[model samples]
Target chain A: MAADKVFKNRIRRKLIQIAAFGFTNCHAGNFITGKLYNGKFKEFCTPGLNCYSCPAATVSCPIGSLLAVTGRADLKVSFYVWGFLLAIGAVLGRAVCGFLCPFGLIQDLLGAIPVHKFRLPKILTYVKYAVLALMVIIIPTVLILATGRTAPLYCKYICPAGMLEGAIPLLLTHESLRDSASVLFWVKLAILLAVIAGSVFVRRFFCKIGCPLGAIYGLLNKVSLYHLTVDRDKCIDCGKCAGCCPMDVDPVKAPRSAECIRCGACKAVCPKGAITIGFGSGRKAAKREGLVDMNVYSRK
Target chain B: MNKRKVIGIVILIAGIALIAAGVFRGELDVILRKAAVVCMECIGLG
Candidate 1:
């Protein structure tokens, strides 16, 4: 794709992200009234980490909904939320993070501020998996089983989206709702600030190291319908794609790496136009052309 | 279809079926009950 086309896609993605946020938080009237929407749509889970406690949020967040069901005394699995997430992941993997997440948009906006940028280490990318396993799943379930007390552990302790969307605005408007303020609120506020600061330097900082939801989507990225492919035949060893990848994915080596959010920045910057990303299999085409795996620049 | 494609399709189908079953089992109600209420913890209240 040409640079101009990439520019158009970038604009289109931003528009889509805005549209997604607006659609999920459709009850704009709730912001003024400072009340959550308690409609039938609340039964359904949104792909992003939208807070149900958010005044304008019409849909339940997938992670929260999952915990709500899973942390029950009966400990029954949440089929609906699970299936919905699986379907979404299977279709496009972490592309949802690229094109739909409201928080991703927030990070992108924050990243636009002119500053000395720093690269977040690849070792830290594995941290989100721990968040999913521990904060989102293991810790909550264990507490519920042991003490018979349930809580949205990740949302309570670490979710910056909740603070931004549900806590801040509601707290500003509903003075009565401020009674719960304590050390926890202060801690959460501090976490939100830290996350915000991190995003200013590293793109999608929370997604890389904090978001349990992204971890789930990342796990399914290998089998997702859409894939990122590099044509070895196009043959210039320039590392432009890897250089442009916000997620630090080496497209030539691991086109379908779990860390890849399918942002398409890599494909856009490839000067040889060697990359094609969509529903079709890039590996099969390479194999059909008798091209082996890209092992030249790839680390063992 | 190849093994990966087949596996993906099977998972997709199984997912849709499970979701439909969840709805029938009133799991949607479970989600609704939790979502409709103003969650204190989610808002960083407690």
Candidate 2:
């Protein structure tokens, strides 16, 4: 039974990685020939933070699309982009962070490297929302409204994903791009290096602390159809769920916390089989009962 | 269903409708044009 479980986990990881790469690889530009695929699929937005500027990217980043439309001189609201994000968030919440985002996949791999892992302070989790509000939304809107110039402030100044997936590949391939690289490029490179290093010691550092997309999705976790539910009756309160969580979410206490990526790591590690992922009001029912209905005694 | 589930369904329906309308209206052309170019600003070159 244990061997079967281990095999299933390995398969799950492989499938998730494949899906992550598949979304990014639809265009599949030729790296050797320095040709990026310019296909029709670029019209749509990918669910995760795959850089549109990346040679292999078939779709635009949703966050980038949001900023692009918001910062346009025309300044029309991107209902399509907003709607797309909302629908996905409502459906899956931050599951995309765990299973779809190429950058998240990279961070997960980096976290596998032998190192002393540590949990970040809970306060730091709120930083992504500030980034979402200030960098991704407010700043770009202000810049466009003030100067009538389109400025993707987050993509330009932050977004180490863009630097890693887009700039690095293009710069290495195209000499002109390399020659034109400036202080901003170097700054982005530094940030990218820091994020990469941080991920090794702190699993999903960017997703936990800085990803505006994650923040947007996190907001919908409470209402999302797919979410984690803890069966308090079965839980031993041994803290196994917390111990197994890579994102430092206490699934037993707050199964629907915004920080949770719905990665199912806790579900896999639960000795008491207390955690489950599903669609419904199971979590709300649990919450209403004040965590395991103490009124009823367990037969165990 | 709960209020949250009802609201989620409404939002999902509305979102799908908006996206479909946008597609029919040729807003995707705008997205395509923006995406066709290598966004220098996105890569921090500009």
Candidate 3:
């Protein structure tokens, strides 16, 4: 199958933009290294829903921070966490996974390499919901009650993001951390390795089948302020939108499907220009041909 | 191969290895203690 020309280039442009941001912000003085994104000058955290814990993180991980504040017995006002999640979700939704998440970006680059892809069974997809319910919420609450201390348990134990963005960097930068590898660290490392390797065989099997955050953000595909709209009038029912969906959404029946990540692949591939992205009152529906000159690059 | 099945098997094996590591040290309780913390802390369910 030929790769979609416009999607490929759009993806590359997004990656380059992220890489350039990373490059410009690599300076520790500018990046704000530590728990507070405020101790000195404020720097842009990767603008995704990643956790803020995991020691090597220069910018705060939002989900981790959110859970931390939420799980806290203290009940302090988590203004940063609330504001950050709201602002990002309101503006971009899960487009963060497609365009901005450093870890998601890494997985996509790995997937872009030629490999035998696997079609995961649908039953496994529920695992992410279980993770969200059990790990993210229930477990943390239980632990806090038991120990009177809270931690981002999922990020600490299960997130490959912690391994990539936290553990590896800390290990590389600190010799003491190398000697301090507990069995738990090895377990997380092994999982990280599997996730990285698995991306080659499964298109975001982690995000599709195991990511609690994806499960949460994906729901916004329908009602999020920014969203995808499908024109039933223009849709030829070719199933191209569903075919193009990386998260396996049936764009025909539920164009705002929970699994839709708003990656806009459906928009790029719609033969009849049936799908579109819209915001606020300017959301007048249009046929595909209406957006003929609307280059995909500029929209993002 | 199912990733969860693979993870389950790995966890089982690791649990066994940890038991052995404890038995050799003549401190079975230590293994349980270590694993208990991890199980509670790592599984995200505490």
Writing each residue's lDDT as its tens digit, candidate 3 over A1-300 gives 124745684676576647734642344442233221232212223455343333323454555644545455654223444444444544556666666666676677787789777777878878888988887778777777777676666777788876665566545555655666778787888898898888888876688777776766664444455567765656678988777677777776875566666777777777766677656321244523354333321211
Off by over 4 Å in 3: A1-25, A28-46, A49-58, A76-83, A280-300, B1-46
The per-model lDDT (C-alpha) reads: 0.82, 0.80, 0.57
lDDT score at residue A298, model 1, on the 0-100 scale: 23
lDDT of 1 by residue, B1-46 (tens): 6666676677778778878877877888888998898888766786
Each predicted complex: what DockQ?
A: 0.73, 0.67, 0.02
Which parts of model 1 are misplaced by more than 4 Å? Answer: A282-300
What is candidate 2's CA lDDT for residue A135?
86
TM-score of each: 0.91, 0.91, 0.71
True contacts kept of each: 0.76, 0.60, 0.02
- Report the first chain's TM-score for all candidates: 0.91, 0.90, 0.80
Chain B vs. true chain B: TM-score per candidate: 0.80, 0.80, 0.57
By TM-score rank, best first, the candidates go 1, 2, 3
In candidate 1, which residue pairs clash?
none
